[model samples]
Target: MEWYDKKTYIEVYPPKEFSFYECIAFLSRSSQEVLHQIKDGSIYKLLKIEDSLVLCRIRYEENAIKVDFPDRQPEKEGCSLVAKFIWEWFDLEADLKEFYQLASNDGILKGIAKSYSGLRIMCIPDLFEALVWAVLGQQINLTFAYTLKKRFVERFGESLMFAGETYWVFPTYEKIASLQVDDLRELQFTVRKAEYIIGIAEEMVSGNLSKEKLLQKRDFNEVKKSLVSIRGIGDWTANYVMMKCLHDTSSLPIADVGLHNALKNILGLERKPSIEEIKEYAANWSGWEAYATFYLWRSLYDEAI
Candidate 1:
């Protein structure tokens, strides 16, 4: 994870292409975000590690991401897990040189790559969170999606009180596996979304699906097929999960409205571009489709409200 425990806090050194500011900006895009809180250029999040709650204050310091414990620091083992989580969350292992090279030649991405050079594909790290979040966002505006998420988390997720503030972690699959559709519907989640999330949680509880098993498939199509094999998970959901959870660089969610809007802004079009045209413009993105799309999403900071 490229980090070490400095006794007081853990220091994580990310790749040169990573910008803590850019990532924190993305995280802070939603004022309704309950998972993390951004304050004074640092992000505060409550994480569950080895069944314990760890409150972390993450900020950039001397070219490295410093994780300090505002509540309490766990043992060395917990520190390592937090470091690994940070690595995956920021996608530090990814080499963006090739993606930048590809973006330079594409008209749609050329300026974006340069404008947001150090931005990485901030990931969900947890497969269940990624899947359920994608489901919650389906066919909803970004602001409303975040509202649903906040309501869902505040209702079912665990929280820790630290210095007069409550920090939360995403509700575990085990917690949601026992829930019924009506339980989630009370939080304003659609019937289909509630079913989809509960079903996914049940699958996890039954040991039928997992991030490990999905990645074991290796091939992109195989992974997509496995995800789509689950009811309510379609092509867009599969691609979104692959990119955010599995770290699949080639995963492209072409139907994303934010991507279309970014293209409209960059290409100076009066209307949204056709799906076929998006495919053609994105042809060069090939292996870097996920990165390209993420960069485009960043172009519209209000994409998530």
Candidate 2:
């Protein structure tokens, strides 16, 4: 058992009602996330800000969350950047109480809120990483997707050793965009996937796409259109990026297997809901569709729900 680094405590005050442990549970959904270290109910992650790789440990403490980096003391600007990234990544400012109020009338969402009250959407906070992860998960089981992610990160990402363990940061666009398709071949990337990954990275490196630009869009539809215009991005991928990366609560990928399975299990249906059926049933969700989907996805792990 790993524990928090008490010698280097830094405090982060959340703007809205927050639950540190609940957020960790959401981030822990995938073991393939190499960038984070979760130990003894606290979460640690290596954040790459400019040229510095800052290692942070986060846990609940009083009204504000506590963060500590054992290796060094970060500058004020670096600490601010870390706080901003964490705020967005955990959606600390989102008004989930309003979402809960909305869910109160819906069947599935009501149960979801009751089961996981303070859970927030965990975001990658990096557009390139989110896009690549969405592509890697296409047409495959999550287990295999995680395997691919672990391999890809270890192959190209930067890392540092802390307390005898290595912490990794995702590869930068500059490094990945310069690579040829042949570079990822040994990782078992389908030729098409390799091309797609490289193509997206190239666009990012060229300033054609970015999280800032995407966030500038007016609505979910506009964001979806912009994302789908990029090669290798389709409806499902676009919706996923919008929901997870952009924090668009209205974005919902109706075709997600987890959504289907979760609905089937919750509603006691013998088969998964059709896209048409989901649309009809989810019509009442309106602006809360993403939360609805998230809660259903959580049902996969939380049996008590």
The candidate that wins on TM-score is 1
TM-scores, in order shown?
A: 0.95, 0.94
Q: For each predicted model, how many residue pairs clash, with residues at least 3 apart or on different chains?
A: 0, 0
lDDT of 1 by residue, 76-138 (tens): 999999999999999988899899888888888998899888889989999999999999889
Superposition error at 104 for model 1 (Å):
1.7
Which consecutive 10 residues in model 1 have the weakest lDDT in total?
Answer: 1-10
Error of 1 at 142 (Å): 1.1
lDDT agreement with native, every candidate: 0.90, 0.84
TM-score, prediction 1? 0.95
Clashing pairs in 1: none
Model 2 lDDT tens row, 64-132: 877778766578788888888888788776677778888898887778777887788887788889999
Q: How much RMSD separates candidate 1 from the native structure?
A: 3.2
Which stretches in model 2 have alpha-carbon errors above 4 Å? 1-8, 15-17, 303-305
